[model samples]
Each structure stands twice: as C-alpha cells, then as structure tokens.
Target chain A: MIETFRRVLRRLGSVETTSVLIVLCAVIALLGIFLPIRTSNWMVLPFALLMANLLAALATNARLKSQSMLFAFHAALVAVIVLVGLDRLHAMHGRVEVAEGSMFDASAVAAEHGLLHDLRLGEVRFLQGPFEITYAPGMKRRETESVIRIPEQNGGWREVRVGDHTPLIFGDYRFYTTHNKGFAPIVTYVSASGDSRTGAIHMPSYPMNENKQGLAWTPPGATKPLKVWLHIPEPVFDEAKAWKFVKPTNTRLVLIDGDERHELSVGEVVSLGSAQLRYDGLRSWMGYTIVGQSMIHWIAAASLMACLALLGHVLSVLIYGSRIPAAGAEHGG
Target chain B: MALEPAPRRRRRSHLIAAALVLVVIVAAGVVLEKMPGSGPTVATAPQQSASSGVTPFGQAFAKGIEAMRLGDAHTAARAFDEARAINPHIPEAHVNLGFAFLAMQRPREAATAFDRALSIDAKQINAYYGLGAALDASGDRKGAIGAMRTFVHLSDKKDPFQRKAMSALWEWEAAENGATPQQGEADAKSKPEAAAAKDAAAGETTASIEQQGGAGTGAKPEAVATKDTAAAEAPAPSEQKGEAGAKAESTAVAMLDTARRNNAPVPPPLPAIADMPDALTPPEGVISIVNVWASWCGPCRAELPSLQAFAAALDPSRYRLVGLNVDRDRDFAREFIRDTAVSFGNFWDGRGVFAKARFQVEAYPQTLFLDSSGAVIARVSGTREWPADAAEATVAEILASGQKKEPK
Candidate 1:
C-alpha cells in the first residue's frame, strides 16, 4: 500500500501531470470567460492541483545544493502561484459611487465577495470632494481631477487627489476612477400622511439618456408612481473641461403623473394631488471601480524573481555550462 | 571520475540552492502578509437583508388600466403598480407597467419592469420587445441589441415589433462589429445553453428565423459579454501581466457601470487645448444654436449625429449653427468629427475657460440660442430633443422668421 502511494505521488508530480493540468486549466478558464461558469469555481481545482504538483516537483526533483539561479526561478514561480491562490480565496472586486459631499458607507456599495472573503469594509470611510475635468477647444476631454476627503485623526477631513490614473486606497480597498459619473437630484416626497422623506434620484447615464432624464419613482407609502427628472435649464456639464463637476443650479424637478407635469425649483413645492414633493438642490456623483486583493506585493515580487531567475538560468546554461563541457573535453584528450 | 564528481557537485549545489530559494520566497510572502497594504482585517460584516419582493395580485391592477386606455400613463402606472403591490410575480402586470413607464419617459424603470417580467416568465415574448425599446432609448446600445436579438428570436415575423427590433439590432450590430458574434460557437463548444442564448453574435445565424416573409436579415443579439469582446474592452499592455480574475473582473466592473451595460470603443486621452474662443456669438441675420460639447461626453456623442442630421436638413442661408468643441486633443477631435461625419464649423472651448468667464456655459452640449441679430436669446441647458417631434415645423418657422423683416 505504501509503495502504491509513492507511485501515485510520482505520477502526480510528473511533467505529464503538469501539462495535463495546464491544458485543463486553459480549457476551464476559456469556459469561464465565454460561458456561464463562475471563474473562481473553474479555476480553483486546477490551481489547487497545480500547487500540489509544484510542491511535489520541488520536493522530489530539486538537488538541494548548486544552481541558485534555477532554484530561485522555480521558488518564485511557486510563491506566485501560492499568493494567487490566497488572493483568489480572499479577494473581491466591487464598485461604489458616492454622491458629492455625501459620506461613503456600506449601504451605498454594491459588492460581490470571494468565497472566503471576510468583508471588513465597514471601517472604510471617506467623503467625496469636488471633481474637475478639462477639455480642449475641439471638445475632447483632456484631464480629470477628483478629490476624496478622508477624516484626519485631528478631526478634519484631509483631501487627496483621485482621478483616472489616481486611485484612493482605504481599508485595503483600491478605488479607481471609471468613466461612469453623472447627476443626482435630491427631492423630498411628502406623503398623504404628512410625512416627508428626502432621497436622491440618480438619472440614467448622461449624454446616453440625456433626452430622457426621468426615472419612475414610487414615493414611500404612495402606491402611485411619478416620473421625476431634475430639469436643469442646461445640465451643469458646462463646468467640465473648463471642467469642474457641478450640480445644475436652479434646476427644477419635473414630476409627471400621466399628462400632469409640474416643475418645482429648489426650496419650492409641487403638489402631487394627494401628496406633495419638494425640490431639494441637485448633487453630483462620481463613480468608482473598487478592488480588494491580498498579497499584491508578494505576487509582484515573485513575478520579478521569476523573470530574473529565468534570465540567469538561460545565461548560465548558454555561457557557463558551455565552459564546463569544453573543459571536460580538454581533460579527456 | 574527476569530471563526473564535478558535474554531480554542480547538480547537488543547484538543488540545495533551489530549496533555500523556496524558503526565502515563503519568507517574503510572510513579510508581505504582515504589511498594512496586503489584506483586510478579518471581520464579518452583516449581509444586507434581501427584499421580500413577492407581492400578491388582485383588483387594483385592473383599476389602473382604465387611466391607461385614456392615454394617461400615470393612471396606468398607478393601476399596474397596485396590482404589483399585491402579487409581484405576474409577468403580464410587469409588461403593462413597462408600457406605462415608457409613456411617462421612464425608460430605466420600463427596462427594470421588462427585466422583471422576463425573470418571472421567460416565455413572455413581448417583454423582450419592451426591454429592447427601453434599453435603446436609455442609451444602453449593447443591452438594447441583446434584448432585441432575443425579441427577434422569440417573435414571429408578423409581430408588430419584429421589424423595429431587427432595425435596431442591425444598427448596434454594426456599431459593436460582432462584439458578441460567437455565442453559438462558444456554447456549442462549452454547452452553456442559457448563457449562449443570451450572449454572443448579435448577428449570428444560429437560430433559424420563423418562416415568414420579410424577417430581418438574421442578426441575433447575443449575451452580455464574451471573452473576446471582454479582451477588446480591457486596458491594453496591462492585459499581458493580468490574470484571469482581472480580465473577467474588468469586464464585470465595466458592465456594472450602469445597471446593465456594454463597452463601446474609447477614444484615447490627449493633452489640453491651448486656446479658448473669446465669444460663442452667432452670425448676423441667422438664428443660431451654439452647441457646446466635448469628445468625452457620452450624451454629446449620441446627440451630435442627430444635430448633424438636423443641420443637413436646414437651409444654411437662414441658420448659423456652431458646435463648441471642448476636447483637449485637437487631432482626436478631428478624427471623431471625421468618423461621425460632422460638417458644421466647430470652435475650441479650451478648458471652457472663455465660455465660463463670458457666459454661464456650465453644462455639456448646452445649446445657446440666438435670434438673427447675434444676440443671445436663451440658454437651453440639460439635454434637449433638438428637433423634438416638431423638427420640421420648427425649422420652417425659423426660416420664415429669418426671411421676414422686423417692424420698424
């Protein structure tokens, strides 16, 4: 039985096993990408098997004394794979867009966590500051600048620049700027019960749904829906490129129920027959692509080591290995 | 023996070195684990509670339809919504809700309603048509194509919406250039029937069209994403070092930009412009609309073609229309113009420095209207339906005014 187990290990660590696993991994990855399979599920098995194979190769194959470079390369490859596994176990990628001047919170984020991920994002705290963009004469956007405000230990919000190239790192999550940013209209809906609730209405994507600026909003406690749009005389998109992000000032919320449409500007109220709505000023939202991964540095280091060791291995074989063989030939002669 | 001993020594040394390297790699990973930037603290946050969305259906739904037939979408929405409150699972209710939402210009909600309708009853073929129209109007071109393709698939050629669905599918298919053209191939290979039915080849001829005269040239909208299309949207150069997770996540995150989304080709970023025009004034005796726009602006991109088309229809003798280009890269702007076939004169709005300083040109694609005397008459901010339904009548009216002499 022991001998059989040894044979199994031998086969498992063999190059043929590695090749098969690689091909399987490729196939699985392709299916995950083009098909409906969740990539994490498809990848885990091959990766786990690869890890075992790599460890077996290290244990049974290495000579344990001389070619440091070749050894380092294999070691680095192992580290990279292991680190990647850990990353997969705990990593997550999600997104959150905070309305400007609003606090970033858990409820605002839409996240999908990994299988083993313990989300500790409750501590992640930041407020969105004002953002700016620049455009050339021909109306091509040139630059984008957004600032994120974090509460300082001293009780003030410290600001940091975040843009297309700059990401905000808070609580192990890296927030990158994506191209999805737009307007949010703040309005207070007064129910028939005389209770008013205020909320933000995020418009459909700008310039994309620019012509159609309303969403169907069924106010809390109200059975009937109202079509609401922040009808700015012109959306404050003029501030960009000459570009600073801004809510369109003096914009009115046009509430439509059937053919009955009434406009209400800031601090003004429009009656919804049984209930009323107040136009609270408009606000803007900047979209962010959020990511959390474990051991980024370890993975990066392992990759660097792998490259260097491969180069060293190549040189040693080409330049030094040739010397030893020639020297042996001379001695034989 | 001497030569053999030396080769053996080298091999042994190499193995030992490899073992040591392994130790070091492990140690480095440990060190990284201890670092602040590596991982999040292990704290289990409570998951957000799921909504109990199942409502029962009854009388109020029927009540809402009366307002609907009278062309009062508001009433229809209320009635359908009431029916929804009682029972949320009915696909038919959602379909009517979608229509009511569309009537009220609430395309996103209409889309949500249609999507909900489909989720409940996948066989609700009309929901696909509603989804297509809503997605298309909402500027979700890729989503619109997918929904339309499904509509075309499930719909008979004689269906009223079938031809329109085909037209929309063809337009987006060309725009996407077969972004999802290989669903059947990938599915046939991988056997994910449900996903394949939804993904790949907005124009693939996998499913045979129902036998009828004048079915659209067989272009089907495929699923939300494919690996090839995902790769196409991914950031270049980084992709070489990128893992499978990053590639998939990038596509997913990009799609999540909107509720349901697709990626369009992005114009490369460029340097800021050097100059800003001093005035966005109109020429004398010509009523004008100085449309300020940037290349990066999504709405501006969609609106420009319509503006160009509108300009083409107008008599140049009475209309002075100018596009204010605020793109930083002049060359890219020219490329965009050429690609979009924009013929009108466009001036640079460098950083919008001049416009902001002169006029309160705060929004993108803002149309500043001017009467014949080059005097600014009005500022149309936000998004405008350039011609609205009155494009022809409006243009004719403007031409007549331009021709008439003012009372002395």
Candidate 2:
C-alpha cells in the first residue's frame, strides 16, 4: 500500500506532470476564448488537475521548500487561481431601467448570475434623479451624467453623480450607465372597486424605435388590456444639428381598446367600463448595467505580487549557490 | 533525534492551509449574514378597525379635521397621529395626516402618510389627491399628476374637489408640454367664447329640428340615450332670451353632467385621415351621421336609397350625413354610388381602417352618430326606413341629451 501511494505521489510531482497540466489548461482556455461557450464548467477538470499537481509538487519536491521566495510566488499563483474560480462562481450581471424621480426596484431587473451568486440586490436602495445626455450631429450619443440619491447611515440622503465611465458603487455591486434610454409615460389606473395603481409605461428606445412607440398594458381589475402608443406630433429635436435629450411637447397618448380608439392628452382620463385610465405625463428612464461580486481586482493584485516574487526568486538564485543542492536527478533534468 | 519526514511535514502543512481557507470562507459567510442591511423587512398594518363608539380615537379624529379646517396644520397633524396610534386601521386619519403634512410643506412625509392611507383602504379617494399634491411639491410631477388624475377619475363629477384637482393637473401637465405653469393655468382658466357661441347655435338647431318634427313622440330610441331619470323629466323647449337663456343653459349643463356620471361611453375621434382624400372628411361644428356601407354587402346596397332620401330631407345647416364605403376597391364603391345615384359625399375605407375591428360595425349599413366635436357618441345598427318625421325627432333627442356639450 505504501509503495503504491509513494509511486502515485512521485508521478504527480514529476515536472512532466506539471507541463502536461499546464498544456491542458492552456488548450481549454484557448477553446473557451474562441468558442461560443459562455459557461466555465469545461475548464474545471483542467484546473483541478493543475491544483493537484501544485499540491503534489509542494509535498514531494524539496527545492520549493528550500526557497521561501519561490514558495511564496507559487502560493500567490494558487491564491489567484482559487479567487478567480470563486469569482466566476459568484459573479452577477444585470441590467435595469429606472425612471427619473423613482426608486430603483431590484425586481424589475433583467439579470443573469452564477449559481453561487448571493442575490442581495434588494437591500441596495437608491433613487434616480434627472439625467442629461448630449447628442452630436447625425444622432451620435455622447456621455451621460446621472444624479442619484442614496440614503446615509444616519437618516439623510447623499447625492452621488454616476456617468458612463463612473459607476455607482454600493458594497460589492456597481451600476454603470448605458446608452439605452427612452420616454416613460406615467399613468394611473383606477378600478371600479377604487383600487388605484400608478406606474410608468416605458416606451420603446428613442430614435431607434421612434416610429413604433407602442405597447400593450392591462389595467387592474380589467378583463381586457389596451394597446397604447405615444404619438409625437412633431420632431422633438433636430438630428442634423447637435442637440440635448429632452422630453417632447404636444405628445398624445393614443389608446386602442377593441373597436374603439381614444387619443388622450396629459391629464386626460378615459373610462373603460367602470374603471378609468389617465395619462399623467412623461418622464425619462435611464438604463443601467449592474455588475456584482467580481474579484477581478483581487486577482490582479495577486498576479502582480506573484510576478514580483518570481523576479526576486530568480535574482536570489543567480547570486547564491545551490540551496541544499537542486533535486535535478529526481526531477529527471 | 527522531523527526518527521519532509514529505509528511509538507503534507501536514498543506492540510493546515486547506483548513485555514475553509475557516476563512465560513467566517466571511457568517459575517455577511450578521451585517446590517443584509435582511429585508416586511411592513405590517392592522387590518381590522378598532373604533366602535365615541372614544379617544373619535375625539382625536374630530380634532384633526377641525384643526385642518381651521388651517392649524401642526395641531391637525398631531391629532391625526394620535388617532392613528389609537387605531392604525383608520384610513381617514392617515389621509388627514397627509393633508396636514402637505399644509406643513413637508411633501415627502405627506406622501408617506398618503401611501399608508392607500395601503389601509385603496378606496380613499382623497388620499390619492393628497398624494398627488405631495408628490408634485416634492418634484415628482409625474407621480403627482398620476395621483390627481386617479382622484378625478374616482371622484363624483359634482365633487367640489374635482374641479380643483383637474385644474392643478392641467397646470402640471401643461408645464410638461414646454409651457410655463402660469401659462398652463391661464389656458385652463380661460373659456373660449367660440365654444359658448357654438352651444348657442346647437340649441337653436335643436329647437328648429323640434319645430320641424311637428309633435314629440316620447318613444326612447336606442340612438338617443336618456339613462338619467332627471334627463327624462327635463323641461320642454321654450324661447327664452338673455338671463332666462343663461339659466336654461346652466340647467342643461347640470343635467348633462348628471347624464355623463351615469357611465356614458364617449368615443373619441377617428384616427387621422392623412392618407384619405379631403372629400371623405366630415365637416366639423355640426352633428354628423356617418353611414357605413360596402358594395358587396346586399343590405348596404339596399340602404343607399333610404340614406339618400334621409340626407335630402334633413336641414343641411344643423346635421351632415356622409357615407363611408368599406369596399376593398375604391372604383367599385364609386361605381356603386354612381349606379345608385347617391348624391351624399362618400368616403372609401380602402385600407379597411373602418372595418368591423374599428367601429364595432357588426352588420352592414350601420349608422354612427357623431357629436359636433366629431366624437361618435351613439350608433344605430341595421337598416331602418328613413321617415323624415322620425329622423327629425331622433336628431332633436340626441341634441337634447347634451351630446353637443364637450366632455370634461
């Protein structure tokens, strides 16, 4: 039994084993980069083999133990690998549209996250304020600056400015602004039973879907929902000249309810049976990309430290003689 | 000296490192769980009412309303809060508290109070209005408009607060339309003389139609809805001038308001006819009877003669009768109209825009009754023999039902 275990350890600790594992990891990584696979599952076996090889080398190879710098360098590399795997398992990416003067709702986010990602987004509370976006001639969008209000620890709000490049960082999550924005028609529906609900109907993306700015919505306690379209009678801004994004004027909300159509101005109400729907006004909604639980910074730091330690080890080796003689014969050198 | 082997020592150190990593991970998880803002909180309110007779709760509630009416907002707020503490389920206390907060110029707090009131009883109409006002003051103009619109929607037409809410909502919405709030206010306050002149003209037209009908038949037609009891008992037409005319007009308006509150479905204007020809356009400022027809439908072909006779017999000054052709081919519809010798101006629904899906035209030869503002207020389905006398009475009834009055 002892001989079998010893033989296994020797094979795992061989330099050939390390080289084979490294080659396998590199091939898998190359495939991941080139192929359409989005999951990290395919690389797990290669990583496990590399980790096992590192552990066996630490156990069976005496040269690594003799040099502290070399050992620290390899240890940092192991830490980097572990942290990267952990981050991949826990990372989350999501996108959400929040209207101005409205609180951010986590439930409204369309998201994708790793299986191990702990969803604590609901805990983050903030209100989005008005955002400004400038457009160059020919409708090229520029930088967006959005203001947000976050509650402080002691019963007040702190104003934070977030832009395209600058993210609103809250604990482990960061919200970055995106170019996707459009008008949201604020409306209120009052049911016959007196249940009133107010919500914003986010129109299709501006300019891109300018011609087809309509959606179907069902009111509370109604059997049938109506199709509502925002009709801007005239051009909001000139695309030929540089302009800023602003709400359009003289807009009408056209509602099509089975065999009937009603065009409502702002503050105009239309009755659907006993219930009523009112088009309050319009507000702009900003789209934000949310990233959470990423360990990229830690991984970068560990890699840099490992590189420095490797340099130090190389310098020490050139200056000094063999430390308890190199285990070259055992390594098959 | 007896010592452990180098491999054994290394293996032990590896085990120790692995254990340390596991411990660190566990510690991190525990810390995260115990951290503040990690857990979500659920709001709970007492569902059942506790008030029975006059108690401290009643006294506090009464005090709040009295203080509010006296314009002592601070005192009202305190009393409402006291009433809420005594019985948290009372929605009125929360609504009054919201109003009090609004009076205090603390809109955010007022919004919260209104929200709480809504949670207790969603039917609290005043809470929605207060919430809108609070949101507007707090710079959430959209939310304010939503709340006020909902209030107007639920409130009775004669509710004193209804006018105020509508005026405020118009001002806010006008501001959104690139106009100053004051400009919106001014626009809302001003009533056009043109509208009054149109009403007067409409009254004269109805009276002339009545005189031409030569005796009233009390038979209620489907096209002329007199759903309100008061509308049925309305006074007969009399030639009153000046002060008497103004008083009659006021009475007519009140009766119309009551009829509107009886859940009358007011259809909006048809989609813009940019693609359609100008000949198809119905004239504005007069009641229009649009007769929908298709060349293929036998009933539509049969009704063409009666529609022609009805149009010829009607006084052209008060009412305009037009024909909507739903035939796929415009030439076919024109040829059919020419064949029938129908002189009325005909519009071809070539795009099928005025098909069964649009105007609920379940059958061919359906007639739509459009008010002076071009809103389709009523409809008459199937073919009917156009007797000049019955047609005049129908027109008179539609006019008397306040169809000419613009929707509020």
Candidate 3:
C-alpha cells in the first residue's frame, strides 16, 4: 500500500503532468475570452491541481534534499505557483467612467472582483475634475489629460495630473486612462415636494452615434416618464482645426409630454407634470480601467529567484559532472 | 564542531527557509489589507435647487423650437405666436408657425403664415414651398399649381426642397386632372416630415406631416438648427459654472494658477555642474533623496553640511543623495558649497524651474524622497536632519512587505 501511494504521488508531480496542465489552462482561458461558455471553472481546477503537484514534488523528491542548487530551484518554482494562487484569490479588475465635477463612489462601479477581494476602496477619495483632449486636423485624438482630485489631510483637494504615461496609483491598484470617454449632461429633477436630485446622464459612446442623444427620465413620485433629448445647436467637432472638448455651450434639452413641447437651455428651468425639471448644464466624462493585483510584486521576486537558482543548478552540474568523469578516466588509465 | 552537529545544522537550515516564506506571506497580507480603495461609493444626497434664471426671449424662443421639434402643432403655434408678439420681425418664427399650422391640417392658416413670410422675403424657399404644399392639401388645384411653379422658379438648384417641390408639382398637376400619381396627394403632400422619424411618430398627425416635408428629415441638427445669433453670443455654461461650481471647477485653470504661484525666478547666474544626473533618478533597488535649496534661504543654508555627512555614511549601492542649489549667482552658490565643505552630487538651478513645474514645489528647502522603484515616497518641507542610520531604517521599512509607513 505504501509503495502504491509513493508511485501515485511521484506520477502526479512528474514534469508530464505539469506540461499537460499548462496546455489545458491555456486552451480554457482562450475559450473563456472568445466563447460564451462558463470556462472559469475549467481553468481554476487545472491551476489548483498544478499548484498541488508542485507542493507534492517539494515534499517527496529525495535528490533535491542532497543537491542544494536543485533544491533552491524547485523551491523557487513552488513559491511562484503559490503566489499565483494567492493572486487569483485576491485580484480585482474593473472599469469605471467618472463624470467631471463628480465624486467617484465605489458602490456605483460595475466591477468583477475575486472571492476574497477586500472592499475597503474608500481610503483614497477621488473627485474627477474636468479633462482636456487635443485632436488632430481630422478630429483624430492626439492627447488626453485627466485631472483627479484627492482629499488632503488639511481638508482641501490636491490635484494630480494623469495622462496616458502618468497613471494614478493607489495601493496595489493601478488606474490607466483608456480611449473611452464621452459627454455627460447634468440633469436635475425637482420633485413636487421641492426636493431636487441631480445626476449625470452619460450618452451612448460619442461620435459612435453623434446624432442621437437622449434619455428617459421619471421624476420622483411620478408614474409617467418624461421624454428628454439633447438638442445640440452646432457640430461638436470641426474638420478644419483642433477643438477643445467642451460641452455644447448652448445645449438645449427638448422635453416632450402629452401634446406639450418644452425646450430648456443651459441654466433653464420649467415645470413638468407635478415637478420642475432643470437642465443645469452639460459636463464631460472620462473612462478609466482599474486593476488590483496585490501579490504581483511577490510573484515577480519569486520569478527572479527561480531564474537565478536554475542558472546555479546548470553551472554546478556542468562543473561537477565534467570534473568527476575526467578524474575517473585518469585513475582508470 | 562540524561533524557532531548534523541535526542542529539541518534544523537551522530549515529555519532560514521557513522564515523567508513566512516573511513574504505576512508582507503580502499586510499590503493588500491596507491598499487604498477596494470598491465604489454611493452618492445619493440631494443637491441644491436651480432657481429661475432664464431670459424671457431665450426661454420663449427655446419653447418655440422644442415644440416644432416635437411636431406639436398647437403648442408650437402658441410659442411662436408669443415670440412674434415679443419681437414682430423674426421671419424664422413665422416659417416655423406655418409648418405647425400645416401639420395641424389648418391649410388656410398655414397658407396665410407662408404668404406673410414670402412678403417679408420673396426668396424664403421654405415659405414658398410650404405655401404650395398647403394650397395643394386644401384642394385649391389652380392655386397649388401656380404656387409650386413659383417655388420651383425661386428655389436654388442645390436647395434640398427643390427636388421635392418638383416631384410634388408633377403630382399636383396630375391630381388636378384625372391622372393618378404614384402616391395620393392627400397621403404624401399634406403632411410635414420629422427629422427623427421614430421620436416624432408618437402621434398620427406628426407622422403624416413628417412624410410630406422630408427635406430636413435626414438632415443634421446643425443644418436644421436656426443660426440664432442671440444664442451664439450668450456666455457658455462652463463660465457660469465658475461661480456656481465654487466647490469645484475647471482643473486646467487651477493648474495654471498653481504653476504661476509656485517658484519664481531668482537673480544672478549659477554655474552648471557635470556630476549630477538630471532629476537624480536613482538606479533600481536604491533609495534617492533630492534636496532642493537656494543660497539666499536661511533654512537651506543650515541643512547642507549634515546632509553631506549622512550621504557619505550610507551604503553606496543602496542609497544616493543629490543637492539642487537654486541661487542664480554661480560664484556665490559655489562659494557656499566650498565653505560648507560638503560632498555629494550637486547641481545649480537658478530659477527653480524643474522643481516648480514637475513636483509642484511652492517653497524653498524642499526634499523629495524616492523608493527603489523610482516612485515618490514622500516630500518633506522646511529643514530635515538626515543622520545616516535613521534615514536607512526608514527606507528599509518602506521596502519591507508591510503596512506603508508615513513619509518623514
């Protein structure tokens, strides 16, 4: 029974098993990205199995105990695999589009996080400020600069300028600016109780559907939905020259009711059903991709150590093997 | 000692490996637990109300435009009437009013507004075309033919409505007689077209009108939008946000202001040194302390010698120190350094240009501390005493896999 168990453990930890697991993981990851199937389970199982195999090898390999360089190499490999498991357990990845002059509330983000993801993102408070984008002659974007405001210990917001090259780093999370920004209109709905709620209505990807800009808004305590459309008076982008990213200076909100038509300009207010709807103004929104991998630094260090150990093992084998064979040949002769 | 202690040696070797693994795990756990932010925040608080701040003309004109856009004949007619009552010379208002009346199937009223617009300007293509369509829809056969003929004569070749006018003329001519056109005049020519077909098709009447005047139906909003000089000249909302957005405003303007107020230029010329690397970017896995100072500043004068001493005592491979002298007087700055008898990489910055623009430094005698990865660890202001051991320990603590230490 002990011999059978020993053979089974050795077989599972063999190089062949690890190679098969790696190939299987790669295929499943590709399927997860391209196919509309639940392939995450398939991936997790193999990676978990591979990590167990590495651990088994560390415990049972008797030669690795005597050979210090080989032992260190295998130990480094174990460390790397363990870090990968920890990363999968705690990593988070998500995207959020924050409107200018608006606070980035963590709960509002649509994100995917690992099971053990720590949800204490409130330590760094960020208020998105107005961003600027420069365009080439044909309206091709050349540069993008997003300004972020962080709360200072002394109570005022400290400005941090972030561009494509300069990413905002908070803890293990890194925020990169992507080419996914558009315009957002500030809409205020004043209820019959005189209570007002202000929110940003982000448009469908801009220039993607430049002619269409609208949203359906229902005031508090009202059953009927108000039909709202953004009535821009001019071309947002000029073909002749570079233009600044500015909200329509005279954006008009066209509201439709039952046989009633109302146009409210920027800073305009009018009555709707039992409430007063105000078009406070327009603002721009910026998109950001946020990634959290807390164990990446440890993984990188482990990888470096693994490479060094492998080098040491190779050198030791070359030197000692050559010396022993030559000394034996001379003695035999 | 070596031969008798095999068990002890094995235990000691195991202890080292165990300690390494434990240290790494603990460090990773601490870093993840203390990282800034983990999720989104909920913003549900009510904001202040936007009070009455509309211009009488802007509001009324906007109402007229929106009503027209919505294809609401009665509401649009009332809004346009209000606008004309306020100022009797807006020809666009009359043209839009005619469109509204025509959409309502009030041909006589539509014809009257269209005629009034033509009288104001004979070349008003919309008025001429609308008059012809209105006349045809009202069953006035001869009048419709004549009005359409006039419209075809007066309209430009590139006018979008010209081709529609010709097609409608042929149909009206056929309708006058007993010949049947492809589409009945009652179905095609009687209705005004909507720019956005789906949105305007909310009502049966709007859908009908939307089909008749299909000129601006697919046209861009900029083409359909009237060139309202009043609206064009009005101040943008961003300007208005300046005073109202006191809690926040444009970041560019704020950045510019900070740049202007930071470090001003000093007089006299400072000599350039060849020893220091630009920005004092330390090599990988090494800590760097960049001290920015000016000769005229009293705090900076006092802090130089100790920093030099501390720099010399630190392990060369792990730590580096650079000094930035901001006095423009090269001789004076050089003399100050010589008199202090300090050694370490030092460079001359006569105007505080690099420090102010890049690091947003607002004061003299500022020191920037950096970690091994070249990330800004912390920036200390005023004067700091850097005894070698204390600085080294702090750097090591920062490098450890644990909770982030507050920058000194």
Q: Top model by lDDT, which number? A: 2
Which DockQ-derived CAPRI band holds candidate 3? incorrect
**Consecutive 10-residue window with the lowest summed lDDT within model 3 chain B:** B243-252
Range of the 10 consecutive residues with the lowest summed lDDT in candidate 2 chain B: B214-223
Better of 2 and 3 by lDDT: 2
| TM-score for candidate 1, residues paired by index | 0.47
Better of 1 and 3 by lDDT: 3
Give the alpha carbon lDDT tens digit for every residue of B220-247 in model 2.
1111112111122332232211111121
Two-way TM-score contest, 1 vs 2, winner: 1
lDDT of 1 by residue, B1-408 (tens): 346686577667766666666666666667766655312222222222212211134335434433442335577688778777667766667776776676576779978988998998897776776677678668787888888789789865544335445745765676678554344553345423222212211111111111111011111121112322332344222221121112111221221111111112212222232343334444566667678787678788778877776777666676667787776535446435533556776777665765565556767877666665545565656565667445657655544554433221
**RMSD in angstroms, candidate 2?**
23.7
Task: List all candidate RMSDs to the true structure.
Answer: 25.3, 23.7, 26.6
Once fitted onto the true fold, the runs of candidate 2 whose alpha carbons sit more than 4 angstroms away are A13-15, A26-37, A40-43, A61-68, A114-117, A152-156, A221-225, A237-241, A313-328, A331-333, B1-408
**Candidate 1 wrong stretches, greater than 4 Å:** A1-3, A62-68, A136-142, A152-154, A235-245, A322-333, B1-408
Q: What lDDT tens digits, residue by residue, belong to model 2 across residues A76-165?
A: 677778878888789999999998768899999998887799889999898777788989999999978887877666756677778887
